[model samples]
Target: IMAVPGPSLFTLRDTSQKVVRYHHNRLVASPQTANAPPGGLQISVVPNQFMDPSHFPIIMGINGGTRCLSCGTSAQPTLMLEVSTHHWGVRPRAF
Candidate 1:
């Protein structure tokens, strides 16, 4: 699992237009190889308000690349953002 610093309150609108707030200052993502469809990968994000802050780590995970079988070209790699449950108390103040 990879964790990175994130916003204090991640507010997003749900399908019903209600704003959802997550009390987390970090994001965490974990990538697992999908075996059902060969060469498939699945990434999961964690760190909600309910999670304990002390156990989470602060790091980030990035996917390398996927090469095309025929053309020998590689697909662009993606960096996943996984936040930690712990609050760093280093948020930027409004200017």
Candidate 2:
């Protein structure tokens, strides 16, 4: 049984994009740190507007700038990962 091809799982564009990293919920398989551009940690596999509305919405991390929450209290397979390491930079502090 060796047939690996259902989109080969996914990791980039097709998967939209992501930078998963975790510690409390469990799911940080090798995330030392290097968010690429504006920093890292992303995870997307979307589409479910009010219980599926036609389609078009799978934005995981969109570059860490989108967490439109309404009420709160709902963690399922709960995996909306995003990370930052390499000493977690922010170059600006000499005090």
Strongest candidate by TM-score: 2
Q: Point out where model 2 deviates above 4 Å.
A: 1-19, 26-44, 51-56, 59-95
Off by over 4 Å in 1: 1-38, 57-95
Each prediction's TM-score against the native? 0.18, 0.20
Query: What are the per-residue Cα lDDT tens digits for candidate 2 across 17-70?
Result: 444443465543443346444323344434323222332323243223344211
lDDT of 1 by residue, 1-95 (tens): 33546423222334554432212532222222353223222222334332334534222121321210111112553323333324665522212
User: What's the true lDDT of residue 67 in model 2?
Assistant: 44
Task: For residue 37, give model 2's deviation from the true position in Å.
Answer: 21
lDDT of 2: 0.32
Taken over the whole model, the C-alpha lDDT of each candidate is 0.29, 0.32
